[model samples]
Target: MFELTKLVRPNILSLEPYRCARDDFKVGILLDANENTHGPALSELSETEKILELNRYPDPHQHELKQQIINFRNSKPNKYTETNLEIDNLCLGVGSDESIDMLLRCCCTPGKDKLLVCPPTYGMYGICATINDIEIVKVSLTIPNFQIDIDAILQKVTEDSNIKLLYLTSPGNPTGKLINVDSIVELLKQSYSKWNGLIVIDEAYIDFTAPNGSYSQSMSTLVNQYPNLVVLQTLSKSFGLAGIRLGITYSNKKLSKLLNSMKYPYNISSLTSNVALKATAKEGLAMMQNYVDKIVEQRSIVLKKILDLKYVGKNLGGEDANFILVEILDKNGNPSNEIASKLYNTLAVDNSVVVRFRGNELNCTGGLRISIGTEIENKEMLYKFEKVLNELNA
Candidate 1:
């Protein structure tokens, strides 16, 4: 065991994780997991027939799913090619969240080593780091707009800091602002030369930016050029497979091999693999493309409306992703929390609709992090928002 393992709480390191049937998904009597041998719910019978695969273990290597992803990327005219990197350079995980934990487990020494994060970003990064017993070094993103101050990040990384990882979320969660591609490439180049830390870019929202075609060129080319860079993408967002929980990480072969070796076997369920495999099918891909187009269009309208709103005014930033993050404040300079609470309460009265809130911790407090909903939902939101603003003004 590594030195870090010993430092982790005895309950944590040696603690036998809940051995749900889902946890130990390998060869077994199947009885241990207590899955209903009788079969799935009646409504899901059609899907059960489509998969036709329950008797045997899923492909431990996930060969079909890997090929489909490679094909999907290859079909893109803008994708990068690796002269030496093979499909072996990639590995599938339950979600990017799993890989996040796996990377910390493989690299950071618990209690002694640390990872760097720019917050008001993804909460998952912090959660995974804590569970692994890795100390978090939080360098808050520059205020107003949550763009990273690369200078501050670089300055903080020192010989004594034991910094092994740096996390950047593109079109960052809650903030919905993308860091410039040139800026990110520059950071990767400098960090690798000066420090031994890994630069991980979480591009979960990439598909949302496809129609705009901003980073499409620069991002793909730069990632392969930097050996220390690791890029994570997911099927959950644009692919509309959130329940399936498929995430892809693009990295150099050496790191890929290590991640593959450490991940628990069958971490992805056979059902998930099948759903993901089907998603890359002709009809499924078309559906995803259509959804992305609609989202991009709807996101634009929402941003404009938010900017036009009497209370929010011009403080809202131009969104480059499916969700828009705008600053909402009353004339009193109160944060958006009160207004968002009112909106949430109003929408949820029927118990059929709901809106999400990202508090002040993200620098967008008075702002609501509204996701682009269906056409009806968007219109309803506009009506509700207009009513709320009128009432507040009254």
Candidate 2:
């Protein structure tokens, strides 16, 4: 019942993809794709800048970059990472935003199809759906723990065959918690006759999780095994390479091929590919791990220190990601958006420290999503946050 060909848009399936010259050949005269053979137009350039070849078109397929990503992922000794995972299983995009948009366009036809999202998860899932003219179907994550409302999601999908994609974020954006794996597996089983579709798990914050110093929680391990699974990751978060704008998608080769076919011929730029290649290199991977370790340590310290304040209520999230979500308390000791918003503004404008006010999000009343910073940065935030909270409440 859950057929991929049935699931994808008919036009996307029938259409032919544009072929870039670099797709078949990368060397020689390269008199194709209309790329300027002359070196870059800049007069002054760094050694690395010249090597990047800004004058030419980048590899359309990004096979080498994809392979390097696999190498970085396989550094950890997992069965899937060790075997069966290859360049074919991965797809790279400008950012997860582009990947999200591409998936929306290729699978969910405008005005007819629906996309399911778990609330208090990533905002772009809904934003992209709206942009693509796809209906947004939201199912809120369970209260307090922030786990998926599995029974509700199952029923919704079963009743609605039009729902083509279900989006979930582990170590979510505002929620900062890991979704239950068992619950995910149960849905993927597709016991319901009416529905079973591609499940997109956004793991942008994955590298910062499992505070036990492991990335074992990543849903990527299940990608090769499940044809319906799509795991989205990025170098922007833990890798400190946000400027490079590389987002990764791990799925079965068939679906990967479909995505490749539908995407722009030259979606990944040479600048992004080269920088990402370096960031995912052996040395780069080690450096990223070191930074992740530091952030994890700092997250604990910041959470504990903030929780001590009378104006700060419970730490709502699972404490999994590089950030913490805590409720800003009112005079009566309940979550208060008014006070949180005031504090959020005060911190940004006056104190030179900024944290996201997620009070508008579901189940996140008075919530301030604070990213973990360095020792000095954290100290400044703690001091300024306490001052603002006390002033607002008074």
Worst 10 residues of 1 by lDDT: 1-10
Error of 2 at 278 (Å): 1.2
Q: What is the model-wide C-alpha lDDT for candidate 1? A: 0.70
Task: Give the per-residue lDDT of model 2 (tens digit) for 117-233.
Answer: 988888888889988899999899888899888789878888888899999999888988988767776677663344757888998998887643343677676777777889999
| lDDT, candidate 2, at 194 | 45
- Which candidate number has the best TM-score? 2
Question: 147-234 in candidate 1: lDDT tens per residue?
Answer: 7788888888754448778888886887777776667777876776677777788888877764433215224333446777777888
Which sections of candidate 2 miss by over 4 Å? 77-83, 191-194, 211-215
Judge candidate 1 at residue 1 and give its lDDT.
Answer: 11
Report the CA-based lDDT of candidate 2 relative to the real structure: 0.85
